[model samples]
Structure formats: C-alpha cells, structure tokens
Target chain A: MGTRKIVIEPVTRVEGHGKVTILLDEAGQVSQARLHIVEFRGFERFIQGRPYWEIPVLVQRLCGICPVSHHLAAAKAMDGIVGVDRLTPTAEKMRRLMHYGQMFQSHALHFFHLVSPDLLFGFDADPLERNVIGVARKYPELAVQGVMMRKYGQEIIKATAGKKIHGTGAIPGGINKNLSIAERDGFLKEIDQMLAWCRTSLTIARDYTLEHLDELADFGSFDSNHVSLVRADGAMDLYHGNLRAIDKDGNRIFDQVDYQGYFKYIAEEVKPWSYMKFPFISSLGPETGWYRVGPLARINACDFIDTPEAEVARKDFLSVTDGQPNNITMAYHWARMVELLHAGEKIRELLHDPDLQGGDLVLKGERRGESVGLIEAPRGTLFHHYKVDENDQVTMANLIVSTTNNNTPMNRAVEGVARKYLSGAEITEGLLNRVEVAIRAYDPCLSCATHAMGRMPLVVELHDAAGRTLDRRVRD
Target chain B: MSDSVTITIDGRNIEARPGQTILEAADAAGIYIPRLCSHPDLKPIGSCRVCTVVVDGRPQAACVKPVMDGMVVQNSTPELLQHRRNIVDMMFVEGNHFCMFCEKSGNCELQAMAYRFGITAPQYPFQFPEKEVDASHPDILLDHNRCIMCARCVRASQELDGKNVFQSIGRGFARKIGVNGERALGDTDMAATDKAADICPVGCIVRKRVGFEKPIGQRLYDTRPIGSDIEEVRA
Candidate 1:
C-alpha cells in the first residue's frame, strides 16, 4: 500500500471540538501526527476595552464545564486592579470553599460522565453502549451516585456563589456573599455521603487502572515536565498558591513562585493548523518546554496531598512509578479521582471553619494599572493577565487556559497512539478508539482551550495516498 | 369606566381591570409577554416591541394597548412568536450584543429572551457598529455597543430618580442613550445607586465596583429562563 492518512475529525468523549490526523510516508510508515483544535472564540481580543471589573463574569462564558476557574482566576487578576495583595481570612475561606466545589463537580463530571464508560465497558465496547447513559444501563447504582456526587458539588457552589454556572460571587478584593450558617449546615449534612462516594469512586478508578495496567502504563507515555500549584507546605492547592514545575528527572524546575513571574518562565507558540496556542517553558525552548498540566501533572508535581484519605490514594497512584514524575497518560483519570476525594474532604474541613460565615467579604483598596491571576483549574494551571488604563478599563488582556498548556502533550499522545497501533494494518474502529482514549485521558476542556462555544459530534475519516476518501465514521 | 373586564388570550379567558394594559393584565393572569424597556416599577414605553401581540387581528404593543372586554388577543400563536423572535434578532444584529463576552449575559434580559426564544443566532446580518464606552465614572460604565435603544434609563432617571440626567440623543439608527447630554457619567449627577443605573435591560449600564460576585450557572436566568417566574406565578 502507498502512503495513506487517517483522520479522527471530531475526537469523541472530550469536552469540545478537536481532531487527530496521522500522515504516512511512501513506505506506509508513520511520518507525522497532530491533534488540531478546530474551534476559536477571540475572547482575549474582544475583552479589551471592557471594564476591568467585568472580567470575572465575562470570561466564565469560555467554558461551561470549568467557569468557576475562569471566574476565580479573573477575579484574582482584578485584585491587583483594586491594589489588594491578599484577601481577608473570611473572604479567602469563602473563595476556597467555592473553588473546592468547582473542583469536585468538574472532576466528578469527567470521571463519571466522560471517562467511566470507556473504562468500565472497555475501550472497544459498542459505541452506542459506551456513554454515561450506557454506564447507567450497566451500573444504575453507580450512575445515580455519580449524578448525585456532581450535584452535591454544584449545590455547594450555588449556596456560596448564588447560582451554579456563572454566579457573581467572587469580586476583585473578595466575594459578594458569605456562607450562611444554614447554608453551611446544609452542606455539612451531606459531607459524609460526599466523602463516601468520592472514596468509592477513587477505589473504582484505581481498580480500573490496575486492570488495564499494561496498556495504560505504556499507552501514550512520554517524559515531560509536570506543572501545577502547591500550598506553602508543598501540598496540592487548587484555589490559590504558587506555580511549581517538576522536570522529567523529578527535579524542581521552579517552586513556590508568585504567578506574576509566569511571563519570565512561560511563553506561547501559535500554529497555522489550530487556533489553540502551544504553551511552553521559556528556559527549555519549544520542544522541550512543552510540559503537561491537569490532574496527572498536579499529582506528580506535589510532594504530598493535604487530606489524609487522598494522601493514601496518592501514595498508591505513585507506587507504580520509581519515584520519577508519572508519565503514564492514562493515569490522569486516577489522579482526577484522588483530587475529587480531596475536594470533598476539603469542603468538609472548610465548612467547619468559623471564618466561612464571617461578615468581612470585601476589603477596600486603591487601583492599580495591571495585574496577573493564576489558579489550578480542574483541568490544570490557568492564567489571566490584564492591563488597564487609569480609568480601570481593560486595555489589554491575555489568557492561557489549562487545555492550551497541555496541547502539545495531547498532540504527542495522539502521535504515539497512532504510530503504535495504526502504522501497518487496516485501521479498525477499535484502533481509532484507542487514539481517542489517549486524548480523553487529559480530559481537555477544548471550549476553554480556545476561550470559545458547541453536543459536538465526533467523526473519523480515512484517506488514500491521492487524498481519495477511504472511510469515515461519525458519532452524534 | 368598569373596574374589571374579561379578555381571551391564547384561548384562555382572563380578567383585566380597566386602565390596565394587555401586559399588565397578562401579568395578573400569569401570562408572560416578553418585553424590553418595560418594567413594573417604570412606566411602559413600548420601545422594544418584544411584547407585540395581535389584538382583534391587528398588531399592537401589549405594554401600551389597553385590555378590553371580550377582546380576542393572540399572544402565543406561531406567527406572533416568529415575529417576536425576529424583533429580538434585529435587536441582536443592530447592536453589538456580544453575549459571549458580555458581563450582564446570564442575568441580561435580552440574553434570557434570546434563550427563551431559542435564538441560536440572529437571522439578520450583524452591523458590527463601532460603539464607545464611557468609563469616566468610578462606579459605573455605559457601553454603547450593547445598548438596544430601550430608553429604560431615560424613563428611570426622569421618573424614578428624578435626576433627569439621561436622555435619548438623535433619531433612527443613530439614536442612543446619552448621559447628561453626551457628557460622561461622572460629569452628571448619576450615582451608582440610581434606579437608572439598575434599570438597563441590556448590558449597557452596569455598576463598575463588582463583577462575577456570583458563580456561573447560578445567575437569575441560569437557574431558569426569563419569564419562567411569571409562568410559575400563573400556576
């Protein structure tokens, strides 16, 4: 056979619009593979000239799955506009509580709704029976628990922020509302169930990983720097903390640094094929600087998790490795579940804090011209930087979302899967699914990836050397 | 003048008081007529025409049209709804209503109306009119791009705040809500606490000191589509 091509036009089971293309040489050998993000919404450009204060709410439209991250991140950036370096304890606690809610809900959504079907039913299971509803059909109890688990997290967000999707709770210096005793008690009553389900889900996720250890251990595996935010004591911190990056050799590339200095370490690369920009560490250069983010990267970069239950799970997740940064791509699902457990534990801990119900929500401050905000979104590290005029109107804005940070890695994983499983034989639907499974491991929010919009349909296409259509597959 | 009158709207008989507009009667009867520039607290202006309904086989602005005894009105008919959706689509195209990048988005009445009408995209061509933003005021911002010429602010300032600080400038496509005769908001006596500042049906006028104080998916419209409350009230 002459050189051929295979294209997965809309990678299924991911958050938004994306595709993977594999090119073969004259010998029918893998020559190049790339994952292209086909969607674009020019949020950064359009947000210019908008009032700086409106950013937190305006940017949430970027992605429905992880709007809280954008909300919190944008608010933090505006904190500099108000000239407040740190928020009051009460304000900080409320924001942290909201952040934990976001983390739990997003992770629950990914693990239960997005990835569980693939793991539980096997990657090559009947496509129609390989969805959240399918998982519900096979394991109705787990399905119900999953829905409730996500709902529990959403309810916490609604109670704190005012509503679940795009509540205007977090302001520049602080928040608009504090947790009421009644509201706190409402969540407190459900904390036990939340924790129990989280633990159960974590166990299932671990077993799933072990059952598929051989394939997962080597599937889409590659060495790269891992990045995330860590608390002062080196524990995993999702809401607020310093940026940390660990190299493939398991050495700290950067540790506990203010996110304001991110420009010094990170730079973005743009390509013609995709509107999504490729971000990399400045020191390592483009190819080497492409580090991974999100759950897997977060777990690898942190020394230990703060929550006791999650710390045990974290140890088990890291056991398969020889003390090096875990490079196995499929382990992201496991790391995500561990974080979900930690989120539930953290929510329980914060609810008991007296400061959560305190009256001091906003702190007055002067205005500054520019600022940067950074947070570990459920997907990974998210950055929002803005420059305002003296009138506090945003003159310039830039955002580096979590999915963009992992863009290079996602492409690399696609390349690896294609080269391994697709080089020589007739491409089967099952083989194409393996490639998509690798991409799903990242749980990328492509909507947020481009600061965009989309029940996106997934399609795969095959072509001959002459670009003649060979085969195509689509999933509505 | 009779105290009460009966009218049939959407095939349902409802009571209406004399001097009440069709919209007012609809509100009392638990029927929601989609509208802009119309607020219970403000006098009905009938500028947006979103609530246009067929009364006795004639199109009328429900907010201004008086309820009548034995009147046959069409509120939920396919023709009326399609016309309403077109009016909304025109508003979207005429102004730069960038809901994806707007602050008042989820809570915005215009956006909620669009969602309620299932307006995925406006059928009209986007003008992409270049609009200006007035950020001179420390506590408020007036973005001309998102304005729909609703005149809610004009009535709000003149009638409610008694400030009379806002007025409509020009006519036709060039018309816009001006702050104190085209002066900046800070140059006028309009305070952030003024009713005019809060009465904007679109994202045009917004308080500057706070943003995203609420989380996403939990805003007023996020919880339920606009006009849902009226339906609930009817129930």
Candidate 2:
C-alpha cells in the first residue's frame, strides 16, 4: 500500500493567524497532530517601567482590535494593585454600561461577521458566497443588522470610553465617563429597539444552527476546564471580580481569588515551536495540563447567567447537551450569543437607572501607590498587575491576557478538532480550513494580550510506506 | 464640591452641571452620530466626523458639543452625515488604507466605519502620501502614512502634559501634524507619556514598544469589547 496525500489552500474568511498538521497511523488511526503558531511578540517584557496607572493605558496598546478588553482587564488588575475594592452604585452602573457596550459590538461581530459567514452562507458555498460580501448578497437584512448591531455597540463604547476600538472607559478604582438624564434616556430608548433586533437575529441564528446540527455536531468536540471571573460572592462574573475555574465535572477549583493570587494555581511555560506560551493551572500542570478559556470557558464555569434574557438563552444552550459535557470546541457560538443577549439586557438595565442621570463624572485624585486590575475579556480571564514605587514610577509590570488563559487548552482543543475533522479525510482543503476556523472560534486577539505578529506555513506532502517522499510543497 | 449645571442638547433638556461633555449627553440619549477626535480621557478636539451633530442648527463637534437649554441639535440630518462621510473620505484619501495589505485591516476603526457608511471606493484620487513613521520608541510606532489627521495624537500630546510635540505643518490640502520644530518624535521631548500613537483612529500610529508580542486571534476586544466590561472597572 502507498501513502495518501492531502491539501488545503489559502484558508478562507477570518482574522489574524493559525495553522495545523496531522499525522496518520499504519492502520489509519490518528497517530499525532501539530497546531503551530510560528510567530511571537514579547508583551510580558514590554510593560515594564511604566506608571502603575498606565497598565490599562499601555497594555491596551497590545491589540488595537480588542483594546477595550485589554483596557478593562488591565484597569481591573490595576484596581487590585491599588486595593480599591468598593465602588459607588452610580459608578458601578456607568461602568456596567460601558462594558455591555463592548460586549454588544464584539459579540455581534463574532456571530455575524466572523463565524456566521461559515454557518449562514454554508461552508461549501461558493467563495463569493462565503464572506461578508456573500452575506450582503444572500441575506442583506442580516448583514445590515449585523453592521448596525456592531455599530451601535461601538457607539456605546465610544460614548462611555473615548474611542471605538481602544477606549479608556475603565480606569483603576472607578470609571471615567458619566451619564446625564438625556444621555441615559436616549440609550434606554435605543435599548428596546436594539434588544428586539438582537433577540430576533440571534434567535434566528440559534434556530438556523440548530436545524443544521450535522455541521455543528460533525465539526468538532473536546473536553477541557472552563476558566472565568467570579463575583466576590462566588457567582460567575463577566466583569468586576476574581478568577474562577471549573473542571470537566463542573467542579470549581479556584474561586474569587485576587489577581496576583493567580500565581498560586496557574503556571506559564514556553514551548519551542510557538511564540504563544502555554498556560495551565499548576494543579493540572503535568503533561495532561489541558485547560480552556473564552466562549467555551465562560459557558463551562457559569451555573446561571445574571440577566433574565441570557438565562433563557442558557436553557436553550443547555438543552443542546442536556447538561452533558459541552465540547470545548463547540462552545464558541453558544458563548457568543449568550454574552450578546446578556449585553443587551444589562445595558438596557443600566440605561434605565435614574442614577445614570446623576452628576459625578471624574473623581479628582492624585495616586501615590501601586494598583492591579482584572476582568473577563471576551476570550477569558485577563489580568493587569503593576507595581508603582513611591514616586509613582512603575517598578514592575505583568499582564495575563484572555488568550493566555486558553494558551494551553487551545493547543489541546485544536488537536482534538483537527484530529476529529481531518484524521480520516484524504486531507482536503475543506477539512484543513475547518480545523483552522475551529481555532478562530475563540476569536483570539493576541495584540491586546501582549504584542504579536503573524507567521504561518502552508505545507502539504505525501510519503510512501517505506519513507520515500512522493511530493511536498510550501506556500508563500 | 457641588459641581452641577443644567444644559440641553437638541431640544432635550438635561442637567450636565459639570465635568461632562456634550458628547456624553448625546451618547446617553442614544443618538446616531459620528466622531474621531474626541476621547473620554483625552480632551475633545472634534477631529473626526463619527460624532458630528448640529447644535442650534450650527454644525459642531458632538464629542465636545456643549449642552444648552432649548438647544435644537440634529444628529441624523442628511447634511451633517454627508459631511461626516466626507471627513471619512478624507481619512481614506489622506492615508494608505488598503485593508487587504495591512495587519490592522480587519479591526481598524476607519475601515469598519467605511464599511458601515458604505464608502467602498475612495471617491477622491488616492493621495498615497508618503508620511514618515518614527520607530524610535521601542514599544510603539508612528506611521504617518496611515494618519487621517484626526489630531488625536496632537491632543494626547497637548492636553496630556502640555507637550505640543505634534503641530500641523501644511495648510488646507496638505495639512499634516509634523514633529514640533521640524524634529523627529525622539527629539520632541516625547516620552512614552504621549499616548497619541495608540489613539490614532487609523493605522498611522503603531505601538512598536510591544510589536507583535501577542499573535492574532488571542486579543481581548476581538471577542468582547471594552464597553461590555466597563462596569468591571467601576465595581
């Protein structure tokens, strides 16, 4: 018997970077698989010597694409560093509005623009029908709604923060933006419409995806720990709390711990083949230290969502698995929509609060010490730890980003997805592309996590049983 | 310190009292608008069109738009939005925004808005202007080529510390923010203190300090934006 060949070209529709390779056994049972991200940018080392307050400002520079998440997470960590735990009700409400705004734009983008292209347009659709343009052609309304949803969320971010992509909405200790009666009322009015639109669109999506379980079910499945932020009271927290982790059995491992406290349970180590460092719980730190974060992680850790609408969506989400293990690989879409609905309901609640109209914008202050901050970025738990000396000079800095939270688990999940999707196939481009897309389901933005660049190889080859090379090729 | 006042925007009488901008009122009101120059932390420069609104029938920067009673503000008027579109076009023309070639393409604000407003082609001829990028800073970069003159870099410099390192060199058709006194950014007394590079609406200003430290797909906002986590900071 001779060796078989496989090929996948210019993987379609998504952002940033990824690559995957699979090896076969003699009897065709999967022997091994490699997922390599062949580039690196050192952000952990870059944040040194800045003012403690600048963690949110500086680490935010990591990724322009998702600066808000970095900014917020960094702000949270900075607060931890400074040790300012209590927040005024008004301040808390305003900050909630800003965060919800971020969720709206980001979740909408992921569901409609990034992953929806595959599900809505059909993975096998013509290349023309498989992108943003394709969505515009087939479902102009959806495309338009997606754009509007994203735009509205971004607008909220800009209003509350400073700009759209990377705003300074969340500052250590408290928020910087305030609300007026007029501003609050307008957002409230918009929320009704926005929520209605979102519910309609996402419900349509959930239905569409449900109807086509073949693709969803067949794409991939993997088991891993779900790591996230938990409130001081131990409930799952999307923002404003401590780190939490749950294993495959839904067992809580780390709950409501401080940002710096993460060192006790978590560990980071570099692998030679990739720029991204693999991070996992020290408890799970042997060779089997597979852990996950982001959409999969959030869903895994939560018992119930805080908002009413999201809880309803959760029921639908849970029904799919019937309280069974949620494959880490498939949790991407469910996580996105659940957060979207939560964002809508939460923002609506914030906008309706009477205190949103109160006066108390900027808190006049001159800080004299260090601060740390933490928050759940779209991907997973994120931390910004800074140490400022007496002169307000930064002596040390550290940032643990969302992707970093999933670094170890991502490698494992990718292998699972790749093996399941590509192990048996003749290694067609479709299977390869799907494997890559599965990684993107997390929508990783390393830029905000640290700082990074893109480097990938497109190589495919066939070898005979005796090890004589049949063919090999590398792409530009 | 009871700092408070009553102000109205676009016929909506709201009390801003103190420490808030017209943009805050407008945003809370859920109005469709545009802006690029105004940021929450940075002073309002009114450089971009994304937050433009007509105050008392006079076109003004909504981000900095002050609220006054009986003030009739029109945010969605066709004229103002068209002007915003023109400003966006200037951003497109003034910079090398070939989204296909740039790493920041997919998540770029200018690119996203262009898509939102349906400005596919640069109505004006591409300037392809050759602007200098200062890579002196270890953690960031200033790519002049991608700057749309939103003046954000200028504000981050001026307001942040009264460091006027960036100034408009040319007038009208050739207006650009050059280094102060014809000096490179390194000689402008600019420390990492000047965060203008990160705030640039376009790709012109880049962070060289931590270049490509995090790979794509691992970024935070790429998944959930800052708005969703605003309360996290406050709480």
Candidate 3:
C-alpha cells in the first residue's frame, strides 16, 4: 500500500470551523493526526485605541453563543483598571446571577441541541437521522425542556444584564442595576421547575454515560493534566477564584495561584499549521505541559462543589473514578450536566439573597494602567488582559478565549480517535462521525477562538501519497 | 387681527409671538415638531433637518423659519413623518452610533428619535467610518464616532459659556468637531461644568466615570417616547 491521507474539513456538530487530517504510512498504519483551525480574526487589534470602559460591552461581539462570558470577563478586567479590589455585595451577587444564568443556558444548549442527537441516535446511525431535528422528532419532551430551560436562563440574564444581546449590566467596579423585586419574584416562581428539569437532564447524562461506559472507556480517552479555577478552600468557584491544576492522577501541579499573574504560570506556543495558539503550563514546557479545560477539567481540579444537590451529584460522579479524575472524553457530558444543575441551584440561592436588591452598585479606588481578568467560562477558562493609557484609551489587549485554551486537548482527542477508528483506505460516515464526536466533547467555540465568521460545509477527502485525490465526500 | 400672529399647524390654529420661529410657535402650542440640532436654550442652527415641515407649499426648517400670520403648515402628515424617518436614518448611517454600549444610549436624543420613528435598523448601508476619540480630558470624553455635527456643543461653548472651546472644522464627509487648542479636549479651556459639556444631544460630549449609572428603566427615554413631554402638555 502507498502512503495516503484522509481529511475531514469543517467537522460537524460543533460551534465553529475546524478540520482534521490523518496520515497513513505505506504499511497502512496511522502516521500522524492533527486538528487545524483555519480562520483568523484580529480582535485584539480591532479593540485597540478604544476607551477602556467600552471593553465589557465591546467584547460581547466575540461570540454570540457566550457573549455573557465575554461581557463579565471584560468587566472583571475593567474592575482592576478602576482600582477596585472588591465589589459591593449587591453588585457581586447580580454578576453571579448573570454568570450562573449564562452557564446554565450554555450547557443546556450544548447538551440538548448539539450532543443529544449523537447520544439518542448512535454515533454510527444514519447521517440523515443524526441531528437536532431527529432528536426533536424522537424525543419531543426533551427538546421542549431544552428550549424552556434555555429561555429561563436567558430571562435571568436579561433581568440582571438589562437586555439579551449586548448587556451593559456588569460595568467597571460594579453592576448597573440590582435585581428588582418583581424580577426576583418572577424568577423565584420558576426556580423549582428549572431545578427539576436540571435534575432530569443530569439523570439522563449520568445514566447514558454509565450505560455506555465499556464502549466509551477507550473511545478517544486519555490521561493528561486538568486546569480550572477553585475557591480558596478548593471548592469549585466558576465565577471567581484562584487557579488550580492537577495531574492525571489528581496530584496538584499548581494550586491557589492568582490568575492575575497567569502569564507567569501559563504561556502560549504558536504552530504553523493552526490559527489558534496552544497554551500550556510554563514549568512543564509545551510537550508535557498541555492540559485539558472545560467541564472535565473543572470536575477533576476542584475538591468539592458548594451547592447541596450538586455536591451530592458530584460525589456520585466521582465514585465512578474512585475519587480520582475522570479522564474519559465522553464523561464531559455528565460533568457538564452536573454544572448545569449547580448553576440552577446557584440561581435559586441568589434570587433569595436580599443583597441582590441593595442600592450600592459602584465603587472606585486607586486606578491601575494594566490588569488581567480570568473567568471559567461555560466552555473553559477565558482570559482578558489589557493595558490602558492615561487618556482611558486601551493601548493593548490580549484575549485567550475558552476554545483556544482547549486547542491542544481537542487535537489530542482527535488523534486518539483517529488511531483507534481509522482502519482502512475507504472513509465511512461512521469514521468521520467518530472524529466529530471526540472534538464536540470539548464544546469548542472555534469562532471565538479564531474570531472569524463564515459558513463551512463538511468535506472529507481521501488522497494518495503523491497528493492525488482518490475520493471526496461533502456534507452540507 | 390680534397683536400675536396666528398660524394653523396640522389644521389646528395656534397663536405665536411676532418674531417666533415655527418651532417656537409649535412649542408654545404644545405641538411637538421633532428637532435634533435646535435645543430649547441654544440658538437655532437648522442643520439636522429633522424638523423640516411643509409651509406654504414648500418645505422649511421649523427651527429657523419664522412663523407667518395665517400661515398653513403640515407637521405630522404621513409624507412629513416618512421624511423625518429618512433623515433620522441617514444620521444613523452617516456615523457609527453604537446604541447598545453607548453611555448616552437611553438618554441620547438620536436613539430616542429612532425609537419614536420605530426604526428597527437603518435602511442605508452603514458608513463604519474610522473616527477619533478625544478622551484626553480628565472629566469629559469627545467620541467623534457618535457625533452628528449638531453644533450643540459648539454653540453652547461660544454663546452659553462665553468660551470658544469647540468649533466645527472641515466640511462634507471630512467634517469634525475641533477644539480651540491645538489638539485634544484636555488642551482646551473646556471645563466639566461648562454648559457645552452637558448640551450634547448624543454621546459626543459626556462626563466620564458616570456612564450606565442610571438603571435601564430609569433612563430618560426608557418608558416614554422622545416628544412625550410636549405631547403630554396637550393632554
């Protein structure tokens, strides 16, 4: 056999555009596998010379799917610029409510809209039947639950952030509006129903993972480092916290490091093949330092979850791995559901807190010229670093979005799946789908990572050693 | 017949002072004629053309055209309303008015006018012109992106504050507001308390560090239309 190449362009069932290429040797053995991010958007440069105060609202253009994440993250960075080390209780709670709302809606959207079809219909199921419409046709109630749950979360965001699209809620040093009595009451009325649905979704994911454990154990699974933000006491704190990273066996690589100084601990490496930068722990170097982020990493890095029901659910999830980190790529769905439930619990707890109605919203102290804002976004960790001049104009900006943080891990997942599934010269729909399933586990938002826009169709091409096209399949 | 001049606007008779402009006469009658450049306190400039109304078979700017005795004017006819909507839409596309994140969003006259006209979006293609920001001032910001060249700040600086701090320089598409100083608002004698600082109808000249302080529903035009106050006077 001659050396051959298999290409899957613009993988489906994911947020943004990406492609995978697998190289096979003459012996027909897998030689190399890589995931390539093709688009480029210079957002950091685009925001240069803008006023510092506009950053929170301006960064929302980064991704419509997770605009709240960018809005809150940029606001946190601006808080540092305004010289406030802490926010008022009302401001903090309002922001927390907004963030939890974002997390809940985002996770629900990813699971129900993106992942459910693959789970409901097997990975090898007919391409025509493997989609959101198919899921809706077969599981109508689940589809409705997803839509209503997403709407509820969106309503919470609107109440806190003031609007749905480009919210101006989280301003520098504080929030613009505290929760009104009517808004709080409205959300309170629906809290129990939202919580019930969250529980149901959690059960679905957990049951599915447990049922398919044997098949999924080696299905693109790997052992690596995990990174996330945790509270001072090592509890999972999605909104605000210090950095924590643990090895594959759950040994602390670095714990409780301030994210403001994240550059000193983490650095990004550039590769010629992809537009996205590969970030890794500085001490371990690129090869060994690359780690995973998102729900799996967050679940692995934290010692405990704060909310009552989520903590109980976390205990149940941890038992499967004997209190160790769950490295299974497919386990991301179950972990995400755990977070979805936690976000719902957090929203309920925040609605009842009287501090959310407090009047004191903004405060300012000594000002700083440069600062960094880090948040555990729904997808993973997001970083926003900025340098503002004396005129209040931003002279510099650097953003490490969540999807970019998971770049290396996504590639690794693709390679693992390709090695296990790619057996012959012909490319089957099942083989192409397996690659997409692995990458979709991260829920990567490539549009945010690359900051680009355009529609892409899935194109799978098979080529010979001399670069001759053998066979090509396209799915629009 | 009387000492005061009488004019009929939209078929409603109204009394006006001898030297009062059409806009003033309409104001006295509690009839709202949409105007952007003509502020209550500032001298009428008639630059924005939003207040254009049919008078004696011809269109005239209500802010600058003096009302004539027994004159007939059409202020809110369907044709005039569409004309006003088109003018407002042009103002939107001529400049980059990011109402979503603008500090002057709800309070901005431009935005309020758009809402009153039911403009979901501008009909014309956006210019997306590159503009400059003069945030050099410690207490004020001069964002040219939102500047509609209303000259409210220029007139307020000269006539109200008795200071020649702001002036309109350049013409056509290259037009922009320039400070008396060489460059930057910080170099000018403009003070945060100057009338020019607060006279802007848009987000052009706004106080720093106070944006988004007023909650959404409490903003100036949050629950009411732009000319609701004048309309309420009739009620």
Best model number under TM-score: 3
Interface RMSD per candidate (angstroms): 3.5, 12.0, 1.4
Docking class of 3: medium
Write down the C-alpha DockQ for each prediction.
Answer: 0.41, 0.03, 0.61
TM-score of chain A of each: 0.97, 0.87, 0.97
Candidate 3 chain A: worst-modelled 10 consecutive residues by lDDT? A451-460
**Candidate 2, position A204, lDDT:** 66
Leading candidate by lDDT: 3
Instruction: Tell me the spans in candidate 3 whose CA falls farther than 4 Å from its real position.
Output: A1-4, A25-29, A451-457, A468-476
lDDT of 1 by residue, A254-308 (tens): 8988888899999999887777889998988897989999999999999899899
For model 3, name the residue pairs that clash.
none
Tens digit per residue, CA lDDT, model 3, A1-476: 58888878767878767777888888777788887777677879988887888889888887788899999999999999999989999999999999999998999999999899899899999878889999889999999999999999899889988887677898999999998899999999999999999999999999999999998989889899999999999999999999998999999999999998999988999887778888999999999999999999998999999999999999999999999999999999999999999999999999889999999999997889999998999999899999999888899998988988888888888888888888554557887799899988999888788743322234567778898988776654
Q: What TM-score describes the B chain of model 3? A: 0.98
Output the TM-score of candidate 2. 0.63
Compared to the true structure, candidate 3 yields what TM-score?
Answer: 0.96
Candidate 1 wrongly placed segments (more than 4 Å): A451-458, B1-130, B146-166, B179-203, B211-235
Off by over 4 Å in 2: A1-12, A24-30, A81-83, A361-371, A449-476, B1-235
